[model samples]
Structure formats: C-alpha cells, structure tokens
Target: MDRVTVSLDELPIRDDLRGQKPYGAPQAPLPVALNVNENTHPVPPEVADDIADAVARALREINRYPDREFLALREGFAQYLGHGLDASQIWAGNGSNEVLQHVLQAFAGPGRSAFGFGPTYSMYPLLTSGVGAEWIGGTRGHAYELSPEDAAEQVERARPDVIFLCAPNNPTGTPLPLDVIEAVYDASHGIVVVDEAYQEFAPRDSPSALTLLGGRPRLAVSRTMSKAFAFAGARVGYLAADPALIDALRLVRLPYHLSALTQAAAGAALQHATTMLRMVDEIVVQRDRMSATLEALGYRPSESWTNFVLFGGVADPAATWRALYDRGVLIRDIGIPGHLRVTAGTEEETTAFLEALAEIGAR
Candidate 1:
C-alpha cells in the first residue's frame, strides 16, 4: 500500500506526445468564474423538468444499448439547425472535441497533416498529434482576421489532409466570414471542417457555413449544446455534413457512443430551443457590456462574435491575472502576451469582473 509516483517520461509514451500538454483551463473555487466560456445562467426550470422527464423515461430502458445511429438526436439537431438538413446528414459525439477527434481519426493520422489558422482552437493541434498526424499552423492576418485571399493561399500551400476552420475563431473570438470558408474549401483538396461552436452567438442575420454544405461533400460544420443551451454538464455536440461523411464518422465511433440518457436529455432540450436560446440574448448583452467597459478602461477588446471576449493592452498580464484571481474573479490568461479572455456570465458576475478589473487598473 505504498505510494507510487512515476513521471510520464518513465513510461512507454509516444515520441510526439512526449512534451505535449493537455488542454485545460485553471479550475478553482472562485466566486466568479468567467475563464472557460461557459453559459453561466441556470437552465430554465420548465426546460430542466422536460429534460429530467426524458431522462427518467430513458432509464426504463437502461439495460439496452443506445441507438447506434442516434437517429432521433440527429433529427433534433437537423431541425434545430434548419438549413434543409436531415438525420442522415448528421453525426454527433460526447462533445465537439470528440466530434473533431472522430474527424481526425477518419481523415487525418499516420503521416498525413492537419492544418488550422494559428492561435485557433488549441484542441485542433492536440487532436491531430494524438492521432499520429502532423499539425501545420497557418497564419492569420492583422488583428487575427483571416482574409479570403490569405486563407486560401495558406491552404493551397500546406495542402493538409484535413483543415479545421474555427468559425468566429476561439480564444480570440474573431469572426470568420463565409467567403473565407468558401475560399479555403476551394483551395484545399482535403476534408474541410468548420467548427461553429459559437455560431449561435454571432449576429442573427449573418450567414452560416451550413448554407454552403450542399454540393460540398467534404465539408462539415460542428456544433455543441454546451454553450447556448446551457447543457455543458450533458456534453452533447453534433455535426452536419454529407451523408457519406456521416458514414465516414460511423467507421471510427465506438458502438452506442451516444448514451440513451444523453440522447433523451439533448432531444428534450432541442424541443425547447426557444426557451434555451433566450439566455443567449442576455449573455450577448453581458458580452457587449464587457467589451465596452474594457475599451473605456483602455484595454483593446477584440470584436467578438462568440460568448466571450479577448482583450489586449494590459501592461502586466501576470500581475493583473493574479490580482483578479485574488479578488475571487477567475478569467483566462491564454498566453497571448498582454491578452486575456473571459466568458460572458450573468449580469452580476460581469459587473464583478468589470469592477475588479477597473480597481486593478486604478491601483
């Protein structure tokens, strides 16, 4: 019963994964946690009741495996997305990370390369390397913007086996224009993935990459319920693509990957999509408020189409982060030099962060 401690290097781990770090944010028992870009609002009681009822019904069949195809959940996602999609054109996993991993497994791996714009989703590289694929980081334009020309040029040069385009890109929250997706798709001859985990937070009138899915057999749009639906605890994410691509994913997924309970809970949440999305508007208000307040306080807040904001211009990021941490308000110091990212939380939480930040600036 003696304690045993061994470092990862002592084991037979892969060479590529030798020095790689796992993806994560700081976890702490802070009063206000805006670090991980989660929806801070509680689910509506009525929606929660519906989900609980669905889960209860699913428990009656607990002994049975979930539907391998997850047809009903796919149908719910198709209906929720509503760009003339259907169940056959949909696939899902525990979360969008797993969905993206499935893509890497089927399309990338073993001497192939995956490409993404630099400073994008950190998971793209990790997922690629984990699958034995080389990760090629492409460049973005000024202020983290990716112009159609620049994006297409980069894709054409790398010609990676799989391309991940994080729409309204993560960490920085810079919006990605549909034309850029079009340009990248046209330039690359490989599988194209548009990670739209934050699309719901974008301007309502803006077009989605889903609009470009038709006739594009190699393209996929991935989404998650964790953000706007306040379903992070349930861990549901899905994709919309050609039925052939869906079939490709089926090859790599474990049997009965989506549990009956997960399907039931997500399906019930989709049924109350309207109620769930009402929280998005409030979060958007907080996001905008945070951006404006940051600007007024002399920080350079980036234009965000997601539920979070990445602001720069801090003179001492480490000291400021420590000060905020000490104030019991937690946000992300995502290693962008003077920049830090924060999720849009409830009104009171946002106020607390702003007040803390302002106080730090004053001192």
Candidate 2:
C-alpha cells in the first residue's frame, strides 16, 4: 500500500484554467463608457414601477423557494420570442453565462471536446475550461467573419461534443448568416449552442436559430435581458431548447439559482415589450450613425450587427486606450494587440468619445 498526503493547494487544478482571470470587470468611472457593450439607455421609469409592483406582490413568497420550474417566466419569454414553445422547453439562470455553463456540463467534458471560432465570445473558451472540456480554437475568415464552410470542415474533423456559435458576435459585432448557422447545425454531431445576446441590435433579417428547433434536438439559443432590455444588473438570462434538453439542465442547476426579485423584475419588463422594441430601434439608429462617424474620422470601423463596433489594425491600441482614458473616455482594450471595442452610448457620450479620439489621434 502507498500513502500520500496532499494539501488544498497541492491538488492539481484543471490545466486549462491555470492562469485565467476570474469574473468581474475593472471598477472605474469615465465621462464616456464605450466599453462592456451595455445598452446606453436607462430602464424606463414605468418599467421600474412595474418591477416594484411585481416585487411587492411577491415579497410574502420570499420565504418559500422560487417556483422551481420558473414556468411563468418561461411562458412569458416564449411568447415574447413569437415562436411558441411549452414552458418545459425553457430554463432560466443567473445569466446567459450560467445557461451556457449548463450546456457545457450536460454535453462536453473529459473525453468530449468543445469548439468555437477564434476571436468569438471570450467566455466560450473560458466556460469550456471551467467545465473540464477541451477547448478547440478554430480559424475565422477575413474581417473576423465566421465561415460556414470552414466550421463545417472543422466539425467533420474535430467532432466536438459541443459547439458555440455567437450570432452578431462580440467585439467584432458581425453576425453569422442564417445559411451558415443552418449548415453548421446540420454538420455538428453534438449540441449547437447559438448565443444571440445581441440579436435585438442586429438587422431584422439576421438569422435566428430558434426557428429550426423542432427537428434539431441538439440546437439551443441563449438570450439575456442584459443588452436590449437594459437589465444588466438584474442578471436574468434564459435558454430555449428542446424540452428534453431543458430537463437535463434542471438536474445540474443549484436551487433557487434566480432570486424572486429578479424573476419579478424580468416578468415586469416583459409587460412593456413594445417600449423595449422602440428603445432598441433608437439604439440601432445611433449605432449606424456612430459607425458613419468613425469612418468620417478616418478610422475604419468593422461593420456591426450589435450595439458596439470593433476597430482593428490600429498602430498602438494600448496607447490609444490610455489616451481615451485620460480624456475621460473608457473604451475596451481587448488586449488583442491592435484591437479596441467601443460600445454605442447616448448621442452626447458618443460625440464626446469621437472628439476625444480625434484629439488623441492628433497627439
């Protein structure tokens, strides 16, 4: 017999997460925040009032566990999607981030592998690691576009057990075409998780994987109230998948993962769906104007389908970021060597950012 002693620090941690930063962004305030891709508009007062009313009505129920099924919220969300699915087809979590984690847990890990395009959502790779799965990084076409042909080829080769496709992808803000998503879904042998966190800002024709859910048992779409609904602090995200897949998620989730207050707030937000759509239209218009402004300023901004734009191939992005910070503008420096992502804020904030950029460029 052999005996060995191991301390808490001595146990071997997962190799993929050896040097990753944990969640939470830097805490700093600036005049213009063109970072983190948050909706610039504040939640309307009427929406807030609705939330308060819902919360007040639910206060007495706080002592009991929240509806374990989250049936009411799911039904409301499914109706909002315009495509009807039973409550059994939906699941809620702390955020779409957690929903993604559940998908990874259910499908990928150990011998199984997860694949996502490079320069896609950074969290995809991070989540793959956190779930003890092999993260396969695939190449993208020019302009950070996700190529369906390339993804199909990789799917045939790597045979990943899980795949993440971010429509209107982060940082670059380019959306993958519908045909491409369909092709990838057909090609994938494992679960195809389509993350549509920014679909509200995307063009109306932008392909949504939700329509193909009937036959594609492996397909799931993750959505959040964070962006278009201006509910970042509420931390509410949901997934629409086949009822069987949703049931699998229920087995792994922690109890009461979503608070009663958050459920009430989300339910209330759904009541003013038309108002939310109007706000999204306004933000889309601002995004287009901002893109034009960037081009007019002699900086090439990537075509965007989301609420932000990515400017690539800059000479010194770190210096540029620092200069913007000094000028009371806070934009994201993606640490991708020469890339920066600027979120669309209000008109005044947008103007300030552009002016600051022009001044910085001259120096």
Candidate 3:
C-alpha cells in the first residue's frame, strides 16, 4: 500500500497533454480580491433588475434549444460597437476564451502554426495548442512592446495560419500601437485576431484595432462583457470581422452554444450600457492611483491603459505575493520575473491593498 502511486500520469491522456498542468489562479475568499482583473463592482440594482426581467422572460423558453444564430444578440452587439458593423459581421461565444477557440478551430489545425507576442496573454499559446496547431512565441521589444518591424519580420518568418494580438495586454498592461496591428495584418497571409477584451478600460484617445478592420478581410477584433460591464458571470464575448469570416466560425461552433438566458442578459446589459459601464471611470482613477503609489515607492509601474497595473522591481515577487496574501489582500503574480499585477478595486479595497503592500515593499 505504501508503494502504490496514484496520479493522472498513469492514465491514457493525449501525448501533448502529458506533464501539462491545469490553469490556476487563486480563487480563495480573501478580504480583497484583485487577482483576476475582474470588475470588482457589483451590478447596479437597476441594471440587475433589468437583466433579471430579461432572463426571466428567457426562462419561459428554457425547454427549447437557444437560437443557433443568436441574431438578436448579434444585433445588440452591432449596435453597441457602432463601427458600421452589421449582425452578419458579429459573432459571439460563452467568453472571449471560447471565441478565441472558435477562431482557432475554424482557421488553425494540424500542419498550421499560430504566433503571438511574448509576455502577453498567457492563454494565447494554450488556445493554439488546444486547436492542434503549432505554437510560436514571438519576442516583443522593450517593456513588452510589439513594434511594427518586429511584428512584420516575425509574421513573415513564421507564416503562421493565425496570429493573436492582445491590446492593453493581460499582465503587462501594455497597449499595442495601431501601426503594429496594421503591420502584422499586412504581413500575415492568414487570420489576424486583435483581442480587445480590455478595450473599455483604455484611455479615450487610445486607438482600437477595430478602426483598422476596414479593407482588411483577414482581421477580427474580439471583446468581452466581463471587464467593464460587470458582466463576467454572464460569460458573453463577441468579435467583429468580415461576414465571410464569421460564416466560417459558424461551421465549427456547437449548435446553441450560447444559452437563451445568456443572450437575453447580455442584450439587457447592452441596453443599459451607460449605467453598466459607469464604473469604468472610477476604476481608471483607481488604476492611476495604484500606478502612482507603486511609482512613489520606487517601483517601476508599467504604463497601463487597463483597469490593472503591472509593477516591476519587486525584490522577490513570490514573497511579496505571500506577504500580501497574509494580510488578506490578494493580487496576481503572473510568473513574470520580478513583476505583479493588481486590479483596480473600489476606493476602500484599493486603499487596503495599497496600504498593505506599502508596508511589505518598504520591508
């Protein structure tokens, strides 16, 4: 009995999955949770009432399969995006992750490769592998910035079937310049996905990759309700691209993948877009405050256009993470050497996180 070893390694798993660990982010109930970059603000009562009413109406038809086309939801999204996109050009999924998977499944497969700038969203390589495609991690320049020349050069060499560019990127909080997006789009013969999951949090003047969608048949821009809409639990994400590209996604997506309740809830939220997104201004304020605090303590905080700040120069990020956790404030240590990411919470939560970390940083 003592010699018996129990483990998943003994099972017959896919060769590619061997020794691979499941994705992990701390979900423990802490005094303050700024780890996942979630919009910490709860849905306003007025907006919540509207969503509840919509979902309740949807519940009456719960026995039936949801709309496979999700046209109404698409129309809602098109109206919200307001970039002259029609319903035919918009596609949605359970989340931006699922939307990404749909894009890869439809465009990438065995014998094809995908490329992304290094130290960006950690999910890019994982999603590439999930679609049975080869993954190429391309290098970014200083401060995790993707330059046009580097983007073009890498795309030319890899000649990948798919390319992912994350704007206001996940852990680094570095937003890509539009010229870089165009350079990659021009260089790539295959599909280009500009993930704008954090678009709502960027500065007003920060250009979105959506602006470059015209005349670029191969490009798509992905966005989500999770970040700024305070709709993470609704699990709605969408993309805008050429109608032909959206049609291709239809081939791979499972029928009725988005439930009726989800569509109804998201549509309701979009109807109250102004109210749902009101917290964004407040979050941006706190984000800048966090940046200022980190810099004042002599840490190198990345220039953030998102609701989170990535700071560097931690003598020991792991220890600091542990120290913060001990104090009931949780943040993310994204495995980037000497850096940590913290989401902007409410004023009180932000104050607690900042005060707790200040002592640790000083020590």
Best by lDDT: 1
Worst 10 residues of 1 by lDDT: 139-148
Clashing residue pairs in all predictions, respectively, total 0, 0, 0
Q: Which stretches of candidate 1 lie over 4 Å from their true place?
A: none
Candidate 2 Cα lDDT to native: 0.84
* Model 2 lDDT per residue over 291-315, tens place: 8877887777898999998877578
Which model, 1 or 3, shows the larger TM-score?
Answer: 1
C-alpha-based local distance difference test score of model 1: 0.94
lDDT of 1 by residue, 174-230 (tens): 989999999999999999999999999999998999999999999999999999999
Q: What is the C-alpha RMSD of each candidate to the true structure, in Å?
A: 0.8, 3.9, 2.0
Show model 2 residue runs off by greater than 4 Å.
1-12
